[model samples]
Target: MSFDEDNSPFGAGVPSDVYQTSIREPVSLEVPEDVNPEAVQPNTSIENESPVNTPPNGPPLADWSSGISIIEAGKSTEGASRGYIAYTIKLGENTVRRRYSEFESLRSILSQIFPLLLIPPIPGKSFNLKLLATPPPNGVDTETKLVEQRKKMLQLFLKECLKMEQVRDTQVFHRFLDPNSNFNEDLRTGEITDLPLNPLCSNPFNGLDTYKNILYSYLPPEVHTTSMDLESLHLQQEDNTKQTSLYEYISLYTHIISSADLSFSHDFDKANKKVSTTARKLTDYYTQCGNSFNSFSLSEPGTELSLLLERIGTSYDQVYLIEEGFIEFIEKRFNDYWKFYLQCFGTIRDVLAFRELKGRQCEYIRSSLASKETAWQAFQKSDDESQRLTQAIRKSEGVASKHRLLLEPSLDVRFVPITVPNPPSKKKGAFSYSLSAFSKLKSTIADVITLQPELSREEQTAQLQTQINVLRQCLILAESDISKMDEFINEQFHLYHDEKLVFMRGLLREYCRHLVEVNEKCAEVWLETKAEIEGLGL
Candidate 1:
């Protein structure tokens, strides 16, 4: 979602403002790591669109019927193996190999690797990768044509095998939405291995409200999902009944982003073809435009501008990665759910195989939006605040030039503190440890601000003063919510990224300092209600 114009931050529009607004270090591209030929376009038409690498900001959420992961695949540079990822998915593990002879083993492997897929299995219709590798009467193998026909199928196979570990993350999101689950049995593995609902249970999509109304209409009615209308998605009111946990929401968004990055919904040779084509294009595009982002407007220099902003905005590999990731997430999520379902209720084989997105509709979307919206809103607000402060500096400077000298620039500002209705108050010495940690952080941040070069004593003082206040406010905020960290987990599926989790962790960590207790009252209610449904309905 775009930031508000009126409340703009960073003086992006405030011409006179000198400070960098959306300030962050320039992140280096993965470079040779993402060597694709299509990325190069010696000549390009003017088209300002969402880069292939950027997330597709689609429509609001709806039901599962309205909820298809906006399939924005076919992007990404063949960015090589991530060290962290490689370590996480060590090969030769039971979770990685796809044993075709044993369907259960195959399914297990698929579930671990691909957790968000919704492909209807073409029963009795199976083909092996090894089969495709063999030569045939046609010189190449018949498997070549087979993969070319259903290219995405092969891509899907690789996606599950090579990435998407949602099945491995099952008990997480499930526990998050199902409040009845307990998280006391902390797993030292730093993941949710034990499911409170069914220590063995699991479940999968993208929020499809993005296509304006055109795409939304294409979805069937059986699916249930909440809209992602920007206004509705924002966690504005603390006590509002519509309020959802932000952590869960971010996890969902992360899934969508990952979906685009790892899309491989194609068949063998075709999937390889797709990969090769993309790789060729990327290599060309980047090779042509070396170290010159501003040289061309948006699209690279030599191709017909794509009409769709989603497609035009990013490089080919970026979008491809996202789509591959999305497909992989589905495959992984589904198997996790199925396995968990089997563990939770042995007799409901029918339900495990047949359940749709009808039941978890509202909560899924709600939680996703809630989680992500927090950071988005905060970032938005913070940006706006930064701009306002910068603008104020400009205005005050003009006035001072006319008048005289001053040692410190005082910025007495007013902010409407966001409230979380009856926010769990910090307990006595609850944040002692965090407080100690924060004190050091405060000094560090202060020093960093003080050290920013080339400022007059007056300006440096002003910046230092501003940083002190910001640091102090952040610490206080940390104290208020640190204790709720662990409790939030075992609850959310971690739809967001590390930033979102850290935010929650920070809050909970602060709270834990004072030995504050997490309120499981809400969780208790959720479990009982779910039990009743499983017992009577099943």
Candidate 2:
């Protein structure tokens, strides 16, 4: 329960007892069509383990239990009912029987064994997720890639089918949370509509053409993709299916990860300990490794990574279904797909980087091959193909042509300036006045949050919290404005008042915008104070 430096679960792990590599096939349990919805609420659902035998709480689970290696494949077992707030070491297909936090912790943990996942699975070891990134052999045709892609689809599809039938997940209620988002059906429809009223954009209509231009330019390319021949996209075609749209896929991933059942029964007040505080309590298991008892992020964006994976998973059809808002829950709950859209961002980045490296390596190889007179004709063809592939990769990965160098062979976290929409609508120039208003409001709420000796326990405490909330929401509106402005901007704007947090301004602006607009009184005050919004640098 202590959250000090040492006790902090900086890294998490499964139970130490979960290290068993072999399993006896136990009875199977059938998944029901209607899972108990109440249990689906956050923190209210019952917790279960992977039918492992615990040795009388011998010790808590370590963040990384070195003694155990998950078996390559697991012996299927069914009919298990035990309650624990932790994970079971999964022996079955790593795809199935997810170790509770698999989608989140798995990436980081498995990455340690990366470049290895691209290699074939070890005979007796579990399937490492590397083959996906493994490069194809030399001289392989696109047809071959198509065939391989189809094969993968079939296997994954079948796996998904079996999972639906056999793996009955313990209905864990992720406590309900209230969303700050507002999905106005009308505003979503209009031409030249307004950004939701938030602090940064207290009045996006506030005459800041610079911010407006950013919004105009930032419109998602998908919106304008109507010209592409949908019929030509043969999902069944080998190469067609093999070729993926990283942007669409990852954005969908982000939304799902960001969503929590808004209906989760949240305990906003810290004192409500009696309302069945029985879920996600596994921090106790990973204590030895300086981990916490639970696996929750317990910070802003209070969501679990598993919940995100549950949305638009790698399963081919399901991914599209979620992205296209085919799932009623996802569509209704998430409204806008921005959250899901972001998930694949990192993946898109990686794929682009990969192609760049391949490009450089092939270039050097071809140059050497030609000079040595080793299959010079074939080398020239390959070098051309490599160059084309690099172009395709760059284009697909969402990086502009001029910044192609960012995808170079060696990947480093470089600080590059990205342009954002100008806040005001219909304008193409920067407006210091508009942005300055945002900073003014941010200062206001910040002053509220700072401890005041005179009113440390002020009766207006709730009112201040509400004020802060409004400011945050406005910031969000401003950000959305920026994103939508993408299609309208020719370049990325580098806005850094602090020199640092340049990338963070979008986030802060969103928060501040949200906080300002949520409260009528606060908005009124902001209107009065920032009405002039001039003579000072924005």
Candidate 3:
């Protein structure tokens, strides 16, 4: 269950050389300088220290355990309608109701005393203005849910404090749990006592092999299994989808950039030159045919043939523009993957920190339990007299009662962690989809070109006539791809429904408009060519 440093999701830090190299050359996709790896990296020097089994044989564990509850359930008497988690804590025999402000005062004092300990996060006041305005359906009000969640979180915090040997045994900690005492007055007058300077207790996390080992020990078997499954799935998805797509995109971009200034092969250049000459010859022949024609039908085919040649010439010449578009895509699209990679890396760092903190807490709990048993046994032996022995037994009974209310042997709290949500993904930034579309387009064009031989005829004029018809069909089929533009956009991007719809419609409209112009010109040429050919009876 232990996770080694190599298993860290953030990977290694970008070398110092990368920054220097990027200044002189093209920038790479390595981790950005802003995400300083050292900031969140676990202190490796402290990872070898063992847990503290005995806490310097401290004074008898203080009777600080208490039964905590929420008092003044409804709205406050003050201006606010939503109520706070006003606590009613019973420390020893005294029970008193106190507000959140008092709990904060206790927390502040505890923090100063236990400087090395991972002081649990306190739940903030949970209130919503909207819930106050209108009641929610099915009696599941937002504000009520918020209050309950906060109460549970706060209860867990106090329980964790009691589980710490250093915290629970201290006079300050006892005053903190005591309901009758004014914690603020105690804080001003009471002195803070540090834990005994034992090697293990002084810096608990100073040497640990794996942060995950402690979490796995405390977590339920099912939760541990589920977490492992999720992690495996995450790694698989990242490798198969995110990283693979990024690699492909980078390769494609590099290929495009390297070949941008490269000329077409000599054969293709020669072929293009011949095609241009042939197109000019066709235009000249059409003009000559027009001059000899006596009827409109004969003249019309010649004019149409001339127009088709011009259209073919125009489409072929736009290859440079297409290449430029590819370059522009690379410049903008890489940013999406760059941002996502950072997010993924950051999540891993957070997981590491959380696991380490939980491990320390678990160690504290183990030490506290041992101390509690020892203190209880020592008291029993020291009070051999009937009067003192009877009082010790009574105090022991109270300790057992408070301990039962807090500790959950069946449910370890260390693994019950919280998480932050992922950031929104950009629509145009889906590089995989973009690359797929490019691949499809290239395949389609190649397939269409192969069909040219099927239209071959013995006579040069007949072959030219068939080639024109086939090219016209290709233009129409390609134009129809624009109709599916919206569907393509929807498939490619992770956008909100309304936003996806809007973007799809807008992009499709613009694309269709461009295609319509191309299609219209092709149609005009085809119609004229057909008319003239029919009139010539060829």
Worst 10 residues of 2 by lDDT: 170-179
Instruction: Please identify which of the two predictions, 1 or 2, would achieve the higher lDDT against the true structure.
Output: 1
Higher-TM-score candidate of 2 and 3: 3
Tens digit per residue, CA lDDT, model 3, 1-538: 1111111112231221211111122111112223322233222232223333212222232333344444333334343475444555544445555556666655544443333344544655445623533546754466665555555555656765676555555566566555555665554444422221111122233212223222112211111111211122111222366534433433443343234213223442355346446444544554454444324334455576544444333433342234333333322332222222223222222222222332333333334335444654554455356458789999999999999988856878778778879899767667988998999999999888776742432233343333333323322322232222222222322222233235435543644454355446545655665675566553
TM-score per candidate: 0.19, 0.16, 0.24
Ordered by lDDT, highest first, the candidates read 3, 1, 2
- Candidate 1 per-residue lDDT over residues 312-387, each given as its tens digit: 2233334334434433333333323322222222211112122212222223333433544454556557668977
Candidate 2 lDDT tens digits, 87-186: 1222122212322222232222222212111111111112222222242464234433333333333233223222221121111100000012111221
Local distance difference test, each candidate: 0.31, 0.28, 0.40
Q: What is the Cα-based lDDT of residue 533 in candidate 2?
A: 36
> Candidate 2, TM-score vs. the true structure?
0.16
Span of ten consecutive residues with least summed lDDT in model 1: 82-91
- Steric overlap count per candidate: 126, 99, 8
Best candidate according to TM-score: 3
For model 1, what is the C-alpha lDDT against the true structure?
0.31
